[model samples]
Target: MSDTVVIRRSGQAGPTSEVVDISIPSDQVFERLVRDGAVAVARWLGFSEERLADMQLAVSEAVNNAIEHGNKNDAHSRVGVRFIVRNDRLAVQVVDQGTGLAASQLTEGRPSIQNKLDNGEESPRGLGIYLIEQLVDDVELQSDEQGHSFIMWFNLTTQGKEGVDEHHD
Candidate 1:
């Protein structure tokens, strides 16, 4: 499926709530499109270059996980992304059509190379969730038998003249 994008604005004035909805086929080739769409919205909302890069990586990783892991790279499946734009923050939700992930899989722990080696794991992978959690201000993951939703938020109000702090509230 080709990319389908919808933008809705609640008001024409300053900092009104806006929404950008995008759906694409479960193909890695379309991952960049999703990332670009998110960055475009973030940029328009006055995100700093540093924060823009962070948002780009986090959004790309989420879409990649949705396409590769959730949909199992099935072209027929579709990944949906919804960006909610507000004055103080930007909230994004990426959904995929696949069997849900276990609750244990969505922990806040970051995998380490030493731990992987000690456990004799085949690969030192599974860092997407960790990266997303670190880059974004907040993250909440939900999944069931139907599908999985990776939702994250970024703070926009704090980064004024003082610049962004290390607060991930």
Candidate 2:
């Protein structure tokens, strides 16, 4: 689908953002697929190879969170993703089929080493959220009775190359 792959563009009108969407069953097998898909698109957008590894990690963590925590590894569940392409950033939204996280589980900023240690929490939870926020430029979370969605973003530079752009329903 055209919406599944939107390329960058440049003109007198300046840069206009595009978006891509992806949906997959909530299974661990699809984690690699999502990681590779984001990698491919980021590479096409001319992101640094170093950034690729980090983005892959973040994508994997987010999708894995959706599958494991949100959907409880339910194979019948689905995870929806949307990639928003812009002149200087790429935003990805992964939606899972479950209620949202507690506000306390998220941090408004990067957790300090002291915070991580002194929080008095024995569990290794929230590590993924921390990693994702640290790896990307921004992260947003939203949820309702239907599901929860995590939107993560990173800076991008297509370097002003003329590329393909399409719109799909």
RMSD of each: 4.8, 9.5
Best by lDDT: 1
Tens digit per residue, CA lDDT, model 2, 111-139: 45665578865645677888887777778
> How much does candidate 2 score in TM-score?
0.72
Question: What residue pairs are clashing in model 1?
Answer: none
Q: What is the lDDT of candidate 1?
A: 0.79
TM-score, one value per model: 0.80, 0.72
Worst 10 residues of 2 by lDDT: 2-11
Which regions of candidate 2 deviate over 4 angstroms? 1-15, 100-102, 108-123, 157-169
Q: List the residue pairs that clash in candidate 2.
A: none
On TM-score, the candidate that comes out on top is 1
